[model samples]
Target: MYYTIGEVANATGIAISTLRYYDREGMFPDMERSSGGIRVFSDKELGTLKVVECLKHAGMSIKDIKEFLGWCQEGDATLPQRRRMFHDRLAEVERQMDELRNTMNLLRYKCWYYDTAVAAGTEDAVRDLPDEDVPEDLRDYRI
Candidate 1:
């Protein structure tokens, strides 16, 4: 079934203007237009929009995404290049995940620090605790 641009926007949770900009940027190369110049989107196009959203969330630049879309249009001949692109993206994502995990660990340590301080009614009390009493994962963060 075909959907109007407004319908596509509602379904995808993307702003209508952004979707229009994507169309203008050649992100929707296979999109159809009515004789009267209205854009027509198919259900299949919704899946394409989901991929665009995922790639954008993964930190791909619009120009790079456009290039990837162009590669997509080239069919199986571009499979190796597309695989490498995804592999590179995967590496970046893994690096981001590692950074986030480190941040989370620090946050957890701070939470424990504050909680201990609250229990003792003074930050100094928690700060005086021995290193052996600290969680191993948080030992490096000890006061």
Candidate 2:
């Protein structure tokens, strides 16, 4: 079924402005316009937007997603490129997950340290640290 831009935005929880921006970026070249020239979206277009949301949630840049769409439009000629993109994104996601796990461990350790210091009445043992002491593994996990 077809849907208006507003409807699609409401259903997907994506801002209508962002959907329009994606359309302008050639992510949905087959998108139709209504008789009054408002954007009209097909189910396929909505599906594409959902994929875009997933990619964004995975920390992908708009440029990378645009390139992916370009390769998608070129069909089999860019299948290898598409595969490589997917592989890269997968590797990045795995690294992010590892870092998050490490960070959680560090935070737990820090909390335990603080609790023990308080219980033992030994503030010096709390080991005040610069934020940088958070290991390299978790440094780049900022949201």
Candidate 3:
């Protein structure tokens, strides 16, 4: 099935201008144009746009995605390069997750500290908590 540029934008929830920008960026190599010179999107083109959105959201730069897509068009010869790109993205995502986890842990520890102090009606009580009284994982976060 074919869809107009507006229809593709509506279906993908991306702005029409952004779609036009992507097209201008050579992201739609297989795109077809009507006899009147109007661009029309096929389902396959829509699928490619979805992938571009995914890679964009995954923190890949447009230049990098373009390079990756170029590699894709080169067929089996680029398999190793594609694999390495994904592996690199995975490591970066994992690193981000770890940083977020650490942030959450610190927030949790702060919450517990404040709650304990409020319950005892004094910050002094929480401050003097013995090592054994604190959560094992939060011990390092004690301030």
Candidate 4:
């Protein structure tokens, strides 16, 4: 269905100005325009914007996304390049996942430490706990 720029922004939860900037940047290659210069969007273009948002969330720079969009416009000849980009992004996401997991582990240990201190009515009580009594997962995070 045809939609105005405002409708697209509301549907996608992106600012109208940002959508206009993206249009200015040629991110929406197939977007149409009225004779008076108003931007028009279609459902397909909205889907494309959603993908652009996802790539931005995945840490891709606008320049890189523009380049990727260029490759897309180039069609089948750029398939391998697009595949490599996705593969590299996947590896980076995996690294971020590992870091997040480590952070979560540390936070969990801190929660347990504070909970024990609360139960015993003193931080010193938690600090004085025997090493063998500590959780195995939190051993490395022990003070």
Candidate 1 residue-wise lDDT at 133: 80
Error of 2 at 107 (Å): 0.7
Candidates 1 and 3 compared: the better one by lDDT is 3
Cα lDDT of model 3 by residue, 59-105, tens digit = 99999999998998999999999999989988998898999998999
Clashing residue pairs in candidate 1 (N, C-alpha, C atoms within 3 angstroms) = none
lDDT of 3: 0.92
All-Cα superposition RMSD per candidate: 1.6, 6.3, 2.2, 1.5
By TM-score, highest first, what's the ranking? 4, 1, 3, 2
Better of 1 and 2 by TM-score: 1
| Model 2: per-residue Cα lDDT over 40-61, one tens digit each | 8998897888888888888999
Colliding residue pairs in candidate 3: none
Ranking by lDDT: 3, 1, 4, 2
Clashing pairs in model 4, backbone N/Cα/C closer than 3 A: none
- Candidate 2 error regions (>4 Å): 119-143
| TM-score of predicted structure 2 | 0.78
lDDT of 4 by residue, 14-107 (tens): 9999998998999998888889988889887888888799889888999999999999999999999999999998898889999999898889
Q: Estimate each model's TM-score.
A: 0.91, 0.78, 0.83, 0.92
State each model's CA lDDT, in order.
0.90, 0.81, 0.92, 0.89
User: Which pairs, if any, clash in model 2?
Assistant: none
Candidate 1 worst ten-residue window by lDDT? 134-143
Among these predicted structures, which one has the highest lDDT? 3
